[model samples]
Target: MINFINKFKGKSSMILRKSKPYRYLICILVFMTTYALLAMGLLPEKYSLEVAQVSPATIYAPRTVVDPYLTKLAEDEAVAAVPEVYNLEASITVAALSGLNQTYASLEEAAIEEDPQEQELLLQAIKENLSEEIEISHVRKFINLTSEQREYIYTNTYEILERNLSQGIKIESIDRAKNQVINELTLLTTDRDIRDLLIDINVPLVRANLLYSAEATERDRRQALNEVTEVKILKDTKIIDQGEVVTELHIRQLEALGLQETSSQDFGYYLGLALLIGIVFIIIGVYLNIYNQSILVDSHKLLLLGIIFCLTLLLSKAFSYFSAYLIPITLAPLLITILFDRNIALLLTIPLAIFSGIIVGNEFTYIILALTSGTVAVFSVRKVNQRSDLTRAGVIIAAANGLTLIALSLLTGSFQGATDFIKNISLDIIMGMVAALLSSILTIGILPFLESAFGVTTSIRLLELANPNNGALKRLLIETPGTYHHSIIVGNLAEAAAEEVGADPILARVGAYYHDIGKVSEPYYFIENQLGNENIHDSMKPLESSKIITNHAKEGVSIASKFGLPPVIIDLIQQHHGTTKIAYFYHKAKEQGEGEINESDFRYPGPKPQTKEAAIIMLADSVEAAVRSLKQPTKDKINDIISTIIEDKIQDGQLDQCDLTLADIKKIKEKFAKVLLGIFHQRIQYPQK
Candidate 1:
């Protein structure tokens, strides 16, 4: 029972030592607090004018008076006393009116006479007699006068009679009326009174006579003297009914109230989104760390990820502000994928898009666009090798985003109002390209730090490390030439195998080169650097020898750290040996009957290979060593040895902790076999000479 308690306590202690709950909780708390602080209401209310239906006002203009001053002057008693012009003209008009009437009566009597030629002669005589007094053209024909034309002529003659009377012309009423009728003879062409009168007399003459008429002048003066009307308000302004309860102001107020009520909501929401997004970023960061097999802390990588996320949000916000119809969904995710790694980009893109939607007012259009663009970015740049590849991926993302915007615009019937939606899409494409460029710049700037800090093992970094003059490589050369040479051959073999199976060749090669760095601590003890010197293993016990060999893994880690290798490379250095027993020493201990020798002492301290590249290097290191031990150089032998080494590692469970599956190992084995065969293909089997 005591032993059981002790065991339980020990296990609990170990669990507590490894647990990261406190760190995670702290991260969450800080994020929540930060979000709460930044999400306060920051917008203002909107205002507008209100109006109801009303009738339009009508306008009026008074008729024009030709001679107001003269009429007014004439109205004065002093002015009326002055002598009036043309006093005899009225008398002549009266005699003419009488004579015209007398002629008309004579013509009527002559018309009834039996003789036709005498009647025609008498009518001609009367027309000639009226011609000099009142133009012969004004005389009417007696042959064809319709009733309507006669009535019209009568109305026109009466108007002329009234005008002459009002003007105080001294003429007999009967003669004046007869003369007026005669004056209208030319208008007998039309049957209507108004048209006939207008046809007979000129308008200017009629207007002049009306202007001079005493009655008309009196009426105009009276109208001008009337008072103007005035308007007055009856009541003070007041609010009536607040109909419908809907307006821009009301909506703005509601938004304001919402913001006030949930002051921390936006912050919390966005922060949560940011955290989720950040975690995805970190995961990608972590994976990249692993992928690159980095050995140092990389703040720049984290900063780059943050910048990419921020720029994505900024661009999305700008797009939304500039064109409410544009979708901002895929920009960040697609950009990350195209500019970085597909898997990492995909893992983070979802949250990035969600956060983007929130930043842009949780718009569905933005969500759709983000998702589409992110997917396209990931798929298009799945295996990017160059910066241009990122550009191409960005183009694809932009096109996808544009298509989404257009399609949504069309779907929602918002296309009509978007006069320059196509142009906006072009801008979005440009933005996407810009995003890619920015991402590349960010990646280049951040990769080194991330690789160093996170212990990530990227191809670029591995290539850099693989150079012979690199500090670590150079140190290895000066300290242990044989080990260095061995590492180079192992790196070549591992690189070929990794490349064949689509694993990270640079990472594998670099890892292989650095795998035996621990040998630098005790260069003379290792056979690779002995240069045909006496074997040290002969003098030391098998257990001591195994201890020395296994110590290299530990010593390698220390050296990696001293050189500022990234955590990923350090992990590879540590995990490459796993906890596998040093076989020779374990066998020697058994042969010597050392009672229960601790197998743990002969094994390497390890968490095992966690990535494909690391696992490949481990397999390559063993295969290269075993292949060099081949007695007869033959393709078959080399191939067999390589296959056995891979099979043995698998059987011994060295690859179990890594992500590499059985299928992956088989592929790896095939690659190793092929490479080994190529390297040791039999030179023309020398004819047994």
Candidate 2:
């Protein structure tokens, strides 16, 4: 069981370490967690409810907020207030007039005809057309009427019907039009049959003419509702009273306030959050690929960067739970600046600030604050010479945070009066300062662990290693004191050159200090550690002496790794000599007329300087040794020797693998001359003291 568990653990570790997908999964998981947390209180909730439920308690706006629920409700109310629409048809009046005129013509034709039965039949047909219940006796009296009586009834009935039904007729008001027509016809004639004919024919025919338009009514209501804008509930506004019955409005308010816990309609909200997270990650990925591809491809760098970003975000989010001002926005940027370069730190800071602004709910203000503080943090320790520089950077960042808070306070009108301004601003200032100071303190505390765990070589770590008490350097000093002294001068020259070329001088100095640790293994075998006239190499063969010399680069790397030094320093130890041949021993072997010696055996095993620091150290090692060989060296001799060594290295392709350019080499040469001139400056022969 124990073996099985160990095997399973080993397999899991291998899968996690070797698979890009697993690392990506971890990265996306962290991103999604942050996105979910940010979206929790920021979006509105969807509630499951109906009308008239008892509200559990009073609710107020948690922050400055927009109530989309209230907005929709206002739109609905506006729609309800709109009056119903109807359609008027003028054809109804025209049809009624035509029917009355036809009746009158039938009555006139019946009065002139000798056939009274036909006339009565026509008038009866007209009466039936008006209404099936019209009396037959009334039809007979209408047929017997004179033309004048018929014309009067026709004109009067047609006129009344036109006046009433032509413009519009509501379905509910149909009877009023019928009544008006009846009253108008009654006054027009005293004859009972004439009155009955007009009333019976026209009154029944006076039906509701206007059509109810449901589609048109809805359209009009919608148009009116559209005029109303969305309603927003302000921060701290009271939404309900305790024990108040929950109306639909109350439910809407609760949803708008994001207080309803169970919302089924949050897919869009979560999707938007996902999109935001994806965009931020893509931007960070593209930038790293373009400017720092090594970090993007290497799992250690990628995971370490993600860890720092997430830690900073989580801490900021935690602080925001208490107050947004307590967000230590500078921490990630400062930490990156110390561990990595300022460019990577600066590049990542922008996205960090954007995420902070989104998380805190006031993007403009929070963005400004984060950017100002993060930028200060970047510049503060960009080229940290010692640990104290980190402290100084923290103070500067804190001061910048205070100033930014002051500006924001004044701009936002966050004060009722001068005293209020002072009190509030002071509190905010303290929060900002404490956040920056805490970030600085935390960064310093965690920096060593990060450097060790990630295999990163920061200047602070280099400085720590450069201390005299370091085990390897101490061993070199005690076992090979001459080599240690030689290393110190080489370090000084390399540091000056690195500084002139805008490279890391601290890295150069630290690398130079430990570059000769291999000499400690066999101290007396090398010239620098020899004390008496007899040299150990004089008794040895050229091949043996050359082998000892060649083996030191490999031995130095071994010693550096044993000391737990960074890979960068080990790289310096391994590559400082590059593949340069030990010329004296090689020539001596050739002059001895030994069978053709293989050139490869005399050369140092090397991956020639892989960085500017290592390359600079390589040059310094050779220049310091070459200058030391000159008896009573003058300033001119030191200058010429330094220039020749640099040129020779360039021609030998020693700097080809590193990033050093022609311009950087020129600056390095000038810096060497300046430093070497000081070391070999002409002394004045003053009067004997």
Candidate 3:
């Protein structure tokens, strides 16, 4: 088994390097496509029905929406609960007081008449002008009293009317208010006639003082209506049972959601959904631009991301057609974590979860399931070693999904009877486990295709390539033992240096193991694989010798590619020697040739090391070869050779294209010296027994 040593250092193939505008355009297209899919998927299936029509199928509310008709009913009930409001008419009281004062003046004037007959006639006329409650006898007796007494009666009556009438009195309370006025007048005087006259006068004035105020009444009703909450039709709630007669209420409910045949689509609903989806896309784009600019600028990665998103969405929606719990929500995170880093995978899981939840009829249950399952899958595959590790991750995801379902069931109280509860719980656990397992299975199955399509070297691929039993490594061991031994030592040295500099140690180590794989093709032609005291170069021309040595880098790339090694490993094999010249052959040619010898002919064809790991392998390979050629490589000699080899590469401009800093190169030198000291350390000779 291969030892998996480091975090993944896969490089996605750059299909196209996009300019700024094209990058933005690609993002916009992805966002628009995703939004369009979500919008179309979320729309509920419409039904054609009328009042009294039998429903063909049982319909559940696609999304949680406010039932406009039901909400109006609730508002109406709330308004009914509020009492009617009325206002007191101050003008009525004023009119009553003025009428009383005029009547008192008329009675006083009639009392001033000389003839008793004339005064009686005047009292009769005054009686006719009074309210029906006031009899002619009561008026005549009131005129018989002295003017002072009449004025006193007037003053007490005026006070009684003013006080009682000012307070609001609806039509229902008018009788009680009149009785209150009668009691007050009865308490005013001992004389029956005077009491009778005051009772009749003030009681009549106490007409209904309260008036119905439409504005005030309507204001109170509307306030009560405002306080009533909207009656929402929750998601998954059954709108109509199969074969049940459709009522006006059902029709209205369907109309509110635009599910009715005759109902027009609500543009506001689509607009709002579009805006929300657009915002999420903008946030993700901003995050990528700020943090993952490499992916942002590369159209291939962007296209890959878009394809993954669409595939996950398509599957989620398709699976949701059966049961929401069966949707493989973890697929996105698993694929993303393999293709990219975990941070991006983790961040993007949120939107995928939410969108899947929406696709499955807007259930929060699926949303929670997706989020938890995806998160667990990401953490589980953080350091996968082989393909089987993905299956193990599947089991881990399954366990997490099962536990999450149980917790959700407990929170939602979805279980019913004891028997039903156990059955439902078991089904939930099984479905969640299946979905999670499906995510892993799909990830494992799709990874190879994505790897090939995108030219990405994932951690799983690296671990497989690193195995000693692999075909390429095995061929090197069997055919070119010396080269294989040299490769192993170079691997150890490069791995240590890569670790010290925070480069990908696994990439460097594995690359070193296969750097000289081309030697297997013509094993004895190279010095490492030649027999003792046998040199093929002894008989060969210097120019031909230089060609063989330099051609190995190219040959190694072809071999690695033929073995299906990742492009990263192929690059390492090709760039390990860079363009450094075969100094011995080049100098020999200079000495032997009668004409000028070109330096370019002696150098290896190379694009140079483009990454930190490739650079470390290049340096380690040179250091190992030079140190091995020395006789009695003491610690001082090894250290000097390591420094000289690295310094020569630097001076030759071989390290200029890579991103290694001076400090990093210093650390690499120290690390190489320390590791080489151990490899070439002096050994004590055991005495022969």
Taking the tens digit of each residue's C-alpha lDDT, what string does model 2 give over 249-271? 77666666666654444676678
lDDT of 1 by residue, 1-689 (tens): 97588579657754543445643443455445323322321221222323342212211111111222333433553334433332324544454445434543564555455686876676567556432334332333432245455455445544554455446433334445445545654454543433433333322122111113455545555544442122211122111223443434323222322222323334555556566646754665476667642211333344445555655555556565555334344445544553356666776677667656655555566667666667776787666544455566556655665566667767876534555656445565555445544444544555465555434455556567777888887999999998998888878877887777777776778888898888999999988888776988888877788889988999998898778665567777888878777887788888888677888878877767788878888887888778877877677777677778777777888888777877777787777777777776667766775
Question: Which candidate tops TM-score?
Answer: 3
In candidate 2, the residue pairs with backbone N, CA or C atoms under 3 Å apart (3 or more residues apart, or in different chains) clash, namely none
Runs of candidate 2 with Cα error greater than 4 angstroms are 1-19, 36-50, 63-65, 73-227, 357-364, 684-689
Error of 1 at 662 (Å): 5.3
Reference-based TM-score of each model = 0.52, 0.75, 0.77
Which is better, 2 or 3, measured by lDDT?
A: 3
Model 1 residue 424 CA deviation in Å: 6.4
Off by over 4 Å in 1: 1-351, 361-366, 384-392, 395-432, 446-460, 495-506, 533-544, 580-615, 643-666, 684-689
Q: How are the candidates ranked when ordered by lDDT, highest leading?
A: 3, 2, 1
In the range 351-386, model 3's lDDT, one tens digit per residue, is 999888877767888898899998998999987768
